[model samples]
Target chain A: MTNTENAPSGAEIRLEEVTKRYSGTASPAVASVTMTIPPGKTVIFVGPSGCGKTTTMKMINRLIEPTSGRISIDDRDVLDIDPDKLRRTIGYAIQQAGLFPHMTVAQNIGMVPSLLRWNKKKLAERVEEMLDLVGLDSAVFHDRYPRQLSGGQQQRVGVARALAADPPVLLMDEPFGAVDPITRGNLQDELMRLQSELHKTIVFVTHDFDEAVKLGDRIAVLGEQSKILQYDTPEAILQNPADDTVAGFVGAGASLKQLTLLRVRDVELKQEAITARPDETVEAVRRQLEERNRPFALVLDERDRPARWVHKRQLAQASSLRTAGKPIGDFVSTQSTLQDALEACLAEGGAAVVTKERGRYAGTIDIDTVMATVQRLRDEAGVSE
Target chain B: MNQFFEFVGQRWGSLLFDLYQHGSLVLQCTVLAVVIGVGIGIAVYSSPGGSAIATALTSAILTIPSFALFGLFIPVLGLGVQPAVITLTLYALLPIVRNTIVGLANIDPAVTGAARGIGMHRLGVLTRIELRLAWPSILAGTRVSVQMLMGIAAIAAFAKGPGLGGSIFSGLAAIGSKTAVDRALAGTIGIVVLALVVDGLLVLLGRFTTSPGVRARA
Candidate 1:
């Protein structure tokens, strides 16, 4: 079957004046903060420790019920349903993976599905699919226990287990907080790829602002006692933070960080660069490149995708463009972030080739334009340094 | 020694009967004590006040000498297997109850939190997650209770309770007789054998029932 055909859409979650008060604490752990989490989007709650960011996220799933406030999902009140039954329909993954040590990886992933009363055969197949989705091989890992797995692998199994039942709303509380930085980056990228496909309403909580910028479509920067300091898209937060705390939280390199929020397709591609078919004569391509006053001619293959970069100097040694110059060193897709494009330009030594659908030749993106975008962001934000 | 061997050979049938009776008494009481202890443990383990009370109550019962406990039971329950069973079972409660509290308390909060977060009902968490993880510690408690009851059961003969305790008590009563030492020796040896055998079985039970993931690794 097709992937997106069965992709699960999420339910919108609304919180109205939710507050959690612990007795004798003299103050509510989470203040009377309210916000709506749109369906099929990743919203992050980011703040320093003891900021109650996690408490706000948990209130939606009712793991820690709100002391006062009305919480609803898709217009139905959450307090109306039983917490256990509601939890069954909400995916949850936590730090250290929170995997049960007694159960094997297969059994762990199969936990939620089996609880939802899926039949034996379907549950087994779903567990396998989940393991595969999390990049774990079932044949090797299925019968293995959690202790047998590495930290990152256990975290993958944790995600697989939470997703086994395919709940529409997924709540992740610092799921990658326990891993080393290198593995954490890889896990974050993997989650981004997964979210692009799953499109589940995800509420992710993290203390790290960089992680929030990378993963969240909208970020909720909370202050002490769970006060909502700012709520906006990652771009808005990066370019124009609502307050000094948020700006400080976004930290230095806010403009460079904004580059990650913009994709290659969002920027204008340079079409003045000359291009020639691989079947063309090297002299003809050189003449076109010289006439255009461009330093190089991009050679395209039959499908019109970039195949080689023929410099006027490199083209002189070759007779045919097909056999001419060096192979295309680096290219960025329209979907690739500008930071990615910047990296590609560095690898290519000048212009980075950009492609659209089916890797068809789009145009070129250079380092200067990316720097200009950063400066433009700085100017718009009214900040100079 | 020659006289003791000859005396043992002569009364082998009765000795075997006493041994069987002794083993049965300890086994049944141990099981009954475990059920009661675990039930109390599950009930009170979550609250410090309740755990302390149950543990203190059971430990107080343990402080009463087995003979004195049997004597005290005679006034209320009035003798025979009833007094023996109740007293031994009550005595068995301390280790099992204490261990149960410790076992239930020692579970990782993350594991229980995960269990609850994933939609397991409270009872489901208790029976499936809590009980399963706590099994090894509970079973260790059960083992301690069983070993203890083996020696204590000999005192059960004070109430005419079944077992090798009957032979040992009678032999003690006839202390000046030539066969007194042999008779007492037979009963004492029978209990020691039974304790070792039952403990071995419990170890086997642990191996077969415990998840290897949780079992202690060398």
Candidate 2:
């Protein structure tokens, strides 16, 4: 089996004057639209229903042919290639997972690889590898049918199937829309992690702006007739939407949504947060807090995991640091978004949010630091908000 | 019942041979109908006009009376199993074709779209995805056709076709004879038993061939 780790980097996709007008319709579903998708980055086509976002994405793989204009992958015209061959080279996944019911999880994942005529051993190995990549235990899931798995698991298999043949380009249309909100968030994170490793040129279509902002490296905010109002980085789109339509799509809570785009680790952590070990005496912790002139100290367990926050006043009244400190109600991880960190701070009613790495205390981000990072990003992007 | 048993004991060999003939004729006609019906079904199901035309034509064939239908075939194909088989095959086509169309049409468009989107050519999508998902419905049609043909094959005896239908028509011709009731009773019992056996086998076939995922819906 060929190792996907050695898979080629994504190919650039370009659309020039692309237009699709259904017969008997006065207006083209997709008017003359042009955009260039950089290799190895995720670009999203986001718009409301009937905005032709899905039609535009399908045109890339030739699932829906453009009535006029040209689409090319890596400078090669898609029209020049047979659609079946073109589709095999470009992975596609859609909502409801669309897994073949008669096939087991392994067969579904190995479909593209099998189409490429990989041998039994190679196909089996690829299926197992894909199952593992999607965080499913191959032994438990490979033999199971799609109906036997939960909605989230089926979507994971859908993604695994799309990546089976190591296609350099992937097109996903509302892939996680059918799953629950929590599952959707997890799947989005999984895709982000996979993208970081695979670097496949991906065209993602979704009506959800939050999803677009979270997953897309660049977002194409589309309007009626598939017009791209703004084609820029998520930060740029969030900071400065092109027009009222784009801003309306961005909708309320723009600042909160912007926080989701920045990770907790994106900002430098303030390490001045004094800490006391769980086994430490309250008197000693109080003395350390007094010496540092800090009102509170974050308590750490034996393994250096964040335990609680010890205040000077609480320590003065209690027998030990472990007993005096308030229980750690919420914490954020390095991989967690700034929005998560802010939420943690708000939930804990604390000025700072503690960061954990694999259950071990990493550092702390104060509310001021989070706001500063947000302000800095806005300023860098030349947006007042 | 005692008279029927006595008749069977007196001519057990001939009776068994007649049962075999009856089974074989029904099997042959059903197999032919399945092949042609499913073929036509797959061909036309993709198009609304074609499906409607195919369905209408087959239903029109079904409305023909069995005696008249078999008689019409006799003039062209001659009086024997050929006419019997042809009439039964014609009768069988309607159910199988209609069910095949329904089964294939009922498949979720997303399923077909996904198959095509993932690079399956038209033929591959049909064979691997659509047909597989539609198997239960198709098999159901076949079962209905087979049962319907089992009874029709008996009527084929009027065309001098194979099966216990000969015993039935002959016995009916001589109603008061000692063996008349016995012969007709055996034929009728054999047809009912054969239908049950064939239906059971079809149910088993459905269970065995259908994928666990598709079957799980039930």
Candidate 3:
């Protein structure tokens, strides 16, 4: 909702007047393009073939030298640095995994680490850990050659290989493109999960719009010759396109697309002080309760964070003193994404209470907030009842 | 029976000695030709836009008539194995150069892109990824060149180059005798055997260098 320029400063990667012109070509493949990618975020470049999205991403890691302009990583000019040494610190993944045909999966994933000369024991452990991180069984894959794996499996190996050395920056160019649609989706989700945990600054190139929306913390929509038409969060790009090019690129239902981008935090949550604590028994809770008719009471830990909810029906099953002092951090955090919050609700097998770290209660979001946000987004998009 | 046994006893030692000497010369021709041709072939192949030059040079050298090229070289190098070896090496470059380019170009772009993206410099990418991926095709080219050179090297013996060609020239010098025809036939068989053996060896080298997974797919 706020201008990105005015947003808090972060570790940024910037490209200024970047251009790539192949020999014998009339024009530069990538024109004067300038953009920034914040640290610990996923930025995807999406466009049709020949649009220069791939070229732009390649320039970040010096895979393709630009004809002009400067590219910087973490505020340092990339040209001043040695390309190979610079690339060693950046994670890169491509379609089909490109695991070394001669190397086994383990060796492929261990490439960067091995190059960095990490001790053998650490390298072995990291390789196995990466394999497991990408959901591959190290035992099954560590010794297996790249050819033995299927397209999807090869891509999983690719991701693990890219992240092997845990570089601060990652460059991925359609890393899942070779796989079938179903597998691609799974890999996308896996990437999202990985990004959440690893928080590496990532530049992803793809031709798929849905993928950009699903994975990108920000999406840079480019036109012919790799000109950026708009670079913004999915919601902003969808709901408030910068120009006709961006509007057309966002396609139909751009309005409702904004709603999908909003999380539960965007909607109001029910907040009240009338809640019980982990140490409070049902009888004592009832005695101290502000309203006896309350159908559900929030449970809190010592830090006053919302924990699990206790329904009146469950009160009869609980002993007076036994239920007291049970820490409720197992309950999900309030700041979780809507989908995660919904999952937590389902996991609780009843109403889910939102809590913060240190057991502070942040209030609960019910089906109402979820449905309202969904309906509001639908209405804004002009969807019929 | 007495004449045949006497003939065998009389020529057997010389025949074995000639076979060993000529056999080594043929092997020498094949190896030298491949080395020279492949050396020039890689240069031409690696040239940004010099394929036409390689083609022209090879085709023109091939057109001079194998004997004529040797004849032209004799005045300078003097009648020996030098001219013959040089001609065979020239002839071998076309196939080797053409195939090397094809192999390098046909390497999956994705693999090369991945190599670069993974932090490999130009040399690293070339040696580790491109060369390895293109190994089979390059070796295929080498095989074609070696087989062709083996046959050509035998013909080189006409210009005083060693090989079974010596026997053929000797046989032709005594054309009126039926024995001459028999000797020529034996020489021809030897040349064919040399070609087959070299070809087999090149194919084996290609197989050894080729990645097992790529071979299985092929």
Candidate 4:
């Protein structure tokens, strides 16, 4: 029943002069690649197939023996230790889940712990905890076999199993590649949520740059022969790619992708929004709107939350703010990203989107404000786009 | 048909004894074959050449005439159940060994890689994951071996091995006699019945021993 809250933080992973060349092959699969992965961060290796990204990852856990070069975790050489023993200290998840069809969900998750000879009771508790951690109910899923679960569920169990022992490092290779697009997006979000709590050092490999940009704390965009073209934060990489090679991988929606990284709360809110109580007389609201030279004023309920928007022309015909102008349906939350804010504005067909904090009216963000903020930040960083 | 019933009624005691002995001989030989075959399969399953050689050798043994194989064993093991059981065990090896190898080899490499990546030693992965996943195919091999050897065990009566095969050869030796067809009919019927019963038991065994996950697939 030891709390993971007190567990040791993730350890640093370092690869120095790492290279792998299969026998009988003229060129090395991965050539002289070296990178330092900061502790408790997720670094993704993204490139096209045959770029040796997977081979490079396999060398970290020694699944594939390195031809030459040094790989060290937390400053200890991986080759210096017994591979099996070293593997027990690291978590590894792969595509297709690779769950043992002969084992129950609980048994699969408890495998490493059981190998370490954990007592049955302790193992059971850990299995339940892992199932919960992955958002699966232990009561319903513990005894079910892999075939009994859906593909997405099976992958969740795979992740739970990898994290069962709470290993400091987790290596995942296309973990969501087999699922449908919607399910893949959900799993990606789930992994992000889990990483916020566990903070394990993760090396995720995928051919999809969008996924890398979404999940990676830092992304290593690799080119042919596993050569790393650029390694930097997702925003930095998008705003300032190392060269045309990296930019090609980043693809056409570079600015739009960058907008996804910025949250609605990241920009300054326009506090100049005119507002009136629901019971306020139309003449008073019209006077206030006129004073501000604004066309519309938000009608607020008793709790200071938006009821509706009242237009200056409607105020002339209406007695109170209660039944004036048009009702706004799309309200963006403070936690929503700038993309969400822009989408909300477009969906509502309004010039600006209202922001809500804890169900109360916070402020508003116009589409122009979002674009201006993004452009200003890009210029400040001296990025061309 | 009446003559067959008459022969059975008169030799009812010995006939039951013959059936029991037939069951024992087939069981013993099949069990021995399973152990040796599965052992060899596991030992060489990892190597392509070794697996090919082992499967080919066992399969070659099956192509040999049963009568000749029994006779060949006579000079070394002599008559009675020894030569008979040995011959049956040899006949049983091909299916068991082939299936065991195929079963182990067919397991998804991703599954084994995951097992190894999760820190299972080679032996642990083989025993706990690979073998368990391969169990259904291995059991199928065992079933084929058991049924095949049951008939082969009847042929073992050429060396005077235990079982109803003795009755069959004896009836054939008396050729054209009234009781000849009766005895042969009884022996043939006995062999078929025994095969059916053994097969039914194996189906039950597969159900009971196979994991629910593997069974769900079938």
lDDT string, candidate 4, B80-101, tens digits: 9889878899889888888889
Of 2 and 3, which scores higher on TM-score? Answer: 2
The digit string of per-residue lDDT tens for model 3 on B90-208 reads: 77666666666666766677777777777777887877776677667666766776666656666777778866777778888999985677667667776677668767876787677
DockQ values of all predictions: 0.61, 0.84, 0.42, 0.80
Candidate 1 per-residue lDDT, tens place, A178-205, comes to: 9999999889988998998899899999
Worst 10-residue lDDT window, candidate 1 chain A: A1-10
lDDT for residue B19 in candidate 1, whole number 0-100: 90
> Best candidate, TM-score-wise?
2
Residue B171 displacement in candidate 1 (angstroms): 2.6
In order, the B-chain TM-scores come to: 0.97, 0.96, 0.83, 0.95
Expressed as tens digits, the lDDT of each residue in A1-385 for candidate 4 is 1235655568899998899999999999999988999998999999999899999999999999889899999899999999999998899999999999999999999998988888999998999999999999878999999989998999999999899988999999999999999999889999999998888899999999989988999999988778999999998999888999899999998988887788888888888788789877888888888887998888888988777987788888997677788888888888777888888878866455555765688888888887897788689679544
For model 4, the chain A TM-score is 0.90
Model 4 whole-model lDDT (C-alpha atoms): 0.89
RMSD of each: 4.3, 2.4, 8.1, 3.2
Tens-place lDDT digits, model 3, residues A1-385: 1225323222469999998999999988999999889887899998887798988888888878899999998779999889888888888898877778877788788888877889999999998899889999977878888889988999998998888887878889889888899999789889988887777788999988878887899999999999988888886576667898777778886644554465655767777535866676678776555365665666765776554556566675777433533334345464566666665656655445766666466777666666677667656645421
lDDT for A53 (candidate 3): 92
Order of candidates by DockQ, top first? 2, 4, 1, 3
